[model samples]
Target: MKFAALLRSAALVTAVALIPATTATMAQVDGRAGPEFAKLFAVFQRVKASYVEPVEDDVLIRGAIDGMLAALDPHSAYLDGGDLQRLETMIDGNYSGLGLSVVMEDGAVKVVSPFKGSPADKAGIKAGDFITHLDGTLIYGGSLDDAVAQMRGPSGTSIKLTIFRPGRDEPVEVDVTRGVIELEPVTHELGAGNIGVITVNEFSADVGADVFSAWQDIKKEAAGRVAGLVLDLRNNPGGSLDESVALADLFLTDGRIVSQRGRARGETMLYDAETVYRGDMAEGVPLVVLINAGSASASEIVAGALQDHRRALIMGERSFGKGSVQSLLPLGPDAALKLTTARYFTPSGKSVQEGGIKPDIAVPQISDPDFALRQKYQTRESDLRGHLINELGIKDEEMESDSIADPRFQLTSAQLEEQGVKDFQLHYAMETLRRTTKSTVALRPAKR
Candidate 1:
């Protein structure tokens, strides 16, 4: 589907919640700042005159812009040319590559998560695994853009990935053939006991509407009243903010969904229930939201809002904790600035910045043999360089709780596999829903 038709706004795009851009009025130049500008110009002139190799002005200027944004935060970036094109492709187009969401940390490319069913995922390239080399060439300390460019190619091509997994003695090598990544943002299934399972792979355009339709389909498939619903947001790195709010609105009848606050007056905004959809679509059904370390910005927003309103029983690991909102400001015809304009808060006025949304029940993914080790080295918003600190000043100890093993969860990967439970977390959630009453699961039923 076309992005414009999906979002109902042609201009808006989704990369951790894209919003409309307002004109930025240049601030009056301060007399004290004049010396800094002069210093910058002086350095530029020296580089132009004394550099060993001739460098284009565009290269130097673009580098300067990149440096400026890099200093701000990990999410803020200057997008142009290939970068812009890639962003568009990621949001709406099919591309040939080992589908992965990655971030550069300390000169190493860290896998955020492999897109479900993509080449990377199929090859067992997991989140928190570091890609140290492509084929035989070392990729450490290289530009992320360059590494990404190298990864993408014509479909049916093969590439070698050397991965460094934490807690492993030796590096692992995997060969994967690049294929077209056609992501299904939302997928649904009607499980046992008339329970519905809706997995939101990403918060792409029309995700909320897609989810609503999925629920309707689930109800029809059950051929009876829906017993429970599990909204799976595991490994979902988040996208459109509007969709997050809209998705939350699906199960909510009234009260606030989320609020964003920015330095600029126009940047701050509030979203409430009943704004996107009228009454709750999933009325009287028990709800559970599944989140994990990979569930970020938009995912956290939905989890937090539902948790705050007592609409759903949040289960699984802590979120990625990206509370900031990125707005795509047009720089020119082909270039744009993806700037972090505002910080979002849950309905309870809590900012999920460095400290992500804490799930009501922290269920470990014991189904994976590497679960414990991967969780040990997992990166979150707090781990990123130049990440915005939570205003509430979260303690380091608060973040450490995710690692503490609970006595209740002692199932091993072998044990789960023997029982045909490939996903222990999802299995646990579905089991919980099967046994729990609606009143116990959700404090407030969605208005009919």
Candidate 2:
């Protein structure tokens, strides 16, 4: 399950939607731009001669490259050495760590969502928890990579995390044992009533193939009586663009899955059903794709496609809006540039830029005790500094709606816990499927 690491960062939808290295032939350098180059050269010379201590040329050059990319966007960065190695590991789908998707919010390490069944998840590390320390050392305002490096250890080793939850006055400590996190990209389980739950954790290499295989196994386990399907893309950061399209194609017999547009011809392309795989794999099964703020790039692509085509009922919170595509350009044998090259659109031509994929139904996770607290501190792509603005110019107030007035969802966490409902969103989706007959599910409803 190797995801294409065409990102400074998240499998939260890193990687180009499609791999197209479109190199434009540059015209002769413009004379008007000479002054800027001269200024940069002068600055370099000044740093080399006047800095407190002399710095290596390679060090300065690398720093300069990073500075340039950082100015562009949060996703763009210069990758080399350890950074490149981490990207490879993410793409290759194996690592030793606490299995958490985290982001830096104003220098604090905030949890995006612990990987499902990962060590961090088992330790009760919920999304929106602010990690203030690792192994007793205060990490506030520290490098995220350094904290991550500290957390990732040989299997069986343990790390202590000090988390500051939003509603709590004090921080809590949790011990997590690192394991050989073999990215189980596609995992399936047959629940009561013969319902199939397929969780796509990452969009790594051959994800489409992996999911198809999972469905085959799921059907077999269900004794060929699959009543419904829950495609859990919750907390799943995105990976490869092609894999996302392929996964969406599994449920779509016809129509466009996703499209990418950019300045280059190669980047502007449309992907449709059967282009990756022929026909819908689970033709008649009712599908409820679950998403949240953690469900990003690649995840959004699949969810958006199925949703726009009325192939699946999208359930859960709005997706982590990361519709921009990144291209991996090799700087040398060991280094590369993860540059934002294009923006993606759903079948209806909706850009996932700032405002992400809004679920057909916004299912809140009321079952979790910390749900209310986490909701207050949750961060999405729009929360990131210098994020790309949506062309539609959506307003912040337009993004969130009031769920408080809804009487049907007034149940407290205590009540849900007592009733043995650990996941309200999933439970609601399952209940919805239980009510929908196979006949109605087979006939794809007219797109709203």
Tell me the number of clashing residue pairs for each predicted model: 1, 9
Q: What is the C-alpha RMSD of each candidate to the true structure, in Å?
A: 2.7, 3.1
Task: Put down candidate 2 lDDT per residue, 73-182, tens digits, no spaces.
Answer: 88988767667766666666578888887766788988877877899989999888899988899999877778778888899999899999998999899989998787
Candidate whose lDDT is highest: 1
Candidate 2, TM-score vs. the true structure?
A: 0.91
Q: Which parts of model 1 are misplaced by more than 4 Å?
A: 1-31, 402-405, 445-448
Ten-residue segment with the worst summed lDDT in candidate 1? 5-14
Off by over 4 Å in 2: 1-13, 17-22, 25-31, 438-448
Best by TM-score: 1
My TM-score estimates for the predictions, one after another, are: 0.93, 0.91
